[model samples]
Target: MRKTIWKSMILSTLAVGSFAFPVPASAAVQVNPVPGLRQDFIKGADVSMLPEMEKNGAVFYDVDGTKMDELQIMKNHGVNWIRVRIWNDPKYGVLGGGGYTDEQRALELAKRAKAIGLKVLVDLHYSDGWADPGQQYTPHAWKNDSPQKLEQDVYDFTRKIVQDFRQQGTLPDMMQIGNEVKNGMLWPVGKLPAKDGGKAFFRLMASGLKAVRDLDPDHKIKLMIHLPDGGDNDVYRKFFDMLVKDNGVNDFDVIGFSYYPFWHGSLQDLQKNLDDVSARYGKEVVVAETAYGFTTDNYDQEKNHYGPAEARRSGFTATVQGQASGLRGVMSDLAAVPDGRGLGLFYWEPDWYAVPGAGWKAGSGNNWENLSMFDQNGKALDSWDVFRDVSDETAPVVPVTVTEMDEPEAEGSTGIPVKLPQSVLVTFSDEHQEMLPIVWKDSAPVYDKDGDYSVSGSVEKIDAPISCDVTIKPKANLLQNGDFESLSLDGWTVTGDKWTAQPTSGKGDAKGEGSLHYWGGTPYQFTMSQEVMGLTPGKYTVQVSAQGKEDSSKFCLFLIGDNGEKKTAEISTTGWNQWRTVKIADVEIKNGKAVVGVDMKGAPDKWGSVDNFKLYRQEDSKAAK
Candidate 1:
């Protein structure tokens, strides 16, 4: 899911205050030539928030530190097309900021893009807010319209928008009928699984198609039917069959798909689906949206959508080179499509890097900064070279030698076999590294005694064996960062008003310099939670060393069992720095995970500090057998 904030271009010069901008560290990726690649292959990016970012004091810099417009940098790095999304009356709501992507903003962006000799693709969301597979809410103004009225509204609205763009000489090169309509658009009436066997959905889609075709009978602008999950073959085959074979609505020229490997299936699945669908339907295919995180670090208060978990799933490391590798992988897959059916791909929101005032909505922070093509400093990432390099696609790079290997790490109780990472990072001769699959006779380490151990394995490409060193010394503390030594809430999710990390003086068995601290001048409630995943079925104990103001403030250490059972231990404090141990024992771990947290509630001047939050397994547990 994409989270973005936009502002009016007129207000781009407004001051939004200062923010920390880190300098670019990695060198630009080296471009390689891919033989037989189409000369007109699309290298696109959706930088709809360019103006909004600029309004919030964002400045774009080229690789060489030359401050410039983001679009110019994109063009310089081989970006040939840009995608801009337009929402119907999104002045207020989730995108509310008086600067949402209305028709005016989209047109302005389109005109600027065209002026730069870059093609523009218009994405019509058909909703005031986000319209994706999970959401397709009817616009507020069209909420009360009948099915017949709604269809006509869609037709008229679409025609008028196209007419405006055409009159301004900024006609889109391509247009998406509706954003990610796999589940249908303009919900309820046109929602999927209709009683009329998808007739409503098809009719709604056909109306939009007819509107665009009516304006441009010569088909100067190609229209596309967009869908999510490009890797799912069954979804594509079934969807297109219903739309074309059964419903006879095939006026669209391109089949657009959104493929995010972390959310969708693997790269192979994407290639298979794209190859099959293009041949089966005989239409051009384009990856409408795709992005990968260059880092797992959170640049703002909002939690990053693509974290370490997503990185591991994407089979790539969270690094600049990994980002380039991912883009190359997608580009290579698209290029391999039989019969040149693959049109190209558009990187989603590549310019929406972190800016203090620019967030998904008001008061929120950026959750997608890690996935942006630019770094926190607004400097272009080396991955931008993928657009330039893919043109010269030569033979694939191979791992000649293992330059580096990331050691695997895991924590579990003694005598239990803990599952280690299946893939390990291996930097190869190509200068880029990937989390390639590894094999070993003893993949899962069974430690009879608690300590640290090294496990060796063979990586897929490297001739030499790679080894991993892990500490069995959790002392059975399943809760990571229990001592808060990281000085950050690395493993915990803090919700409610501003719980912070404060330094501790080794108070009452707290080993780290940091402790989870919370202070509120007014009444408030907060939860600092850590979800420990992949636990063996057994009984466990949750414990924490805590201190607080000796008052009526309610602070409790709690645990939600895997099956949703809850247990809590009320924490009592005598005075500041007078720490006491709070424990909740006999918590059953029926599922493979447990949620442990500290929930606080109180009035003005209430304060608390917690450290050494740990979960311990019972000796006579069922999993121990």
Candidate 2:
């Protein structure tokens, strides 16, 4: 599930909207034949909100306004699998405000999915609400249990849940023991870096695994261990190494990941991580949750979570064509996994249209409306054709070429520009009336002097080799240890009550080993600053990644003058689990000296951290004598 700080907050009243319910279709109605992809590959979606939507009188309509069964529509469009999340004893009833994912609802949905000949994957959140990397609150009933007791509880709860599903003839085809267990599940007890070197965490997870194995004696269900951010290779390496190699608790059959292109890295990063993990662990990899926007337009009153700007950053246009293209690229990457370990992908909540009472929370209608395969009006989009039309055999092939451009003088050069190929050609095995468009980037390479260097790039929307080799020189970063890659605060000074150099708990700077954490206990303030001094004065650009635990906490990145005057840019701590970059442009560095750092003022219950500090002198600035 997507992480949000306000996930548990509830609205006092539900929004009012009109709904038209159509006559229920018979469960035995025959559907179209299953659309085959690569051999045994899974094309799936998570329709956890379907039950709630139906209960609220929401209805699905085809493009012609004909009412249709949601599951049958998905099966006709090539989706063979369905995922449902289960929450343990939610505060709200099964269809209540905050917790709609209770066991009974999940089982009901699972049975309905199975009735449509679709496989089911059960996601065990083990919490009343969302359980992600940011917050993994233990279920209220198990909050006070001892570690040993908690382990037993996990086993007992999992066994009972599986047994219940079996008795109902709706056992999940695949099961996720935990949802996004990147930082460990169930909070402090089962969380990472435990007092005994994560032994307790592994033991807790082991109990859950044992329950799944014992319950499914015939090995009918495949088990999965899920983590967030499928693009982070280091995280996968660190996490699985501890769980499998070091601890010897490798019982899961599949490795599941959540890959949201905007939050995670680029497609290249996703491919690399998937390849590495599949080869190293020899486990089938599945993108358990992924989605792309087809439009930035807000059709409903509720705010659309992804806008045009974010969709563009993801290298795909916020249009139907772009969504289709994005899925094609993703499928291509997954198909390329070594030894065919790539099982497939599941579009997260693609049916979450902007219907009445179908929103993630009360009063707010479908924040992910733009990402749904169906438009806000409940009409299927062109993106749905991606599943029916594009297959491994008929996939579009895109070929790219990169050629070097003549290098100019290196004097005062900040970035080197490379010429792009005149045109990238796309071809398909069968003839097509139109050509598929492509999205690509030609990044400016850093050139310090006139020498040989290498630069990388990527192309999206088709299956193709996206990398090319270019020659250039490299430029030097003025601030030493700017990214904290050295694992020490060698060139930084702390002027406050509390600061520590440590590996960040959540997603840190895109590339780094450590970050400066400021624990300014209640009502305190601290600053971690680094000064770069020399002769040659000019304009510089300062950029840093900083975040805080709470909204009240303040985190600011500043450029300090020699006389102590500071030019600061405030950083928003809204998405504490995600990193946001703060850039101070055109900062004048008179006397060739300035202090660049982050200042954090701690709130009563919050702290802040900063990392990936970078200072670059503008090449266009006048040179100092």
TM-score of 1: 0.70
Per-residue lDDT of candidate 1, residues 170-285 (tens digit): 99899999998877888889888678989988988999999999989999999999998788898899889999999999998999999987767678789899999999999999
Q: For model 2, how does the per-residue alpha-carbon lDDT over 324-434 read when each residue is reduced to its tens digit?
A: 656765676787788888898899988787777766766666678888888766776646766664553443233221111111111113343333222232211111111
Q: Where's the lowest-lDDT run of ten residues in candidate 2?
A: 14-23
- Distance (Å) between predicted and true CA of 122, model 1? 0.6
> Which stretches of model 2 miss by more than 4 angstroms?
1-37, 92-95, 392-554, 560-625
How many clashes show up in model 1?
Answer: 6
- Quote the positional error of residue 573 for candidate 1 in Å: 25
Least lDDT summed over 10 consecutive residues: which range in candidate 1? 14-23
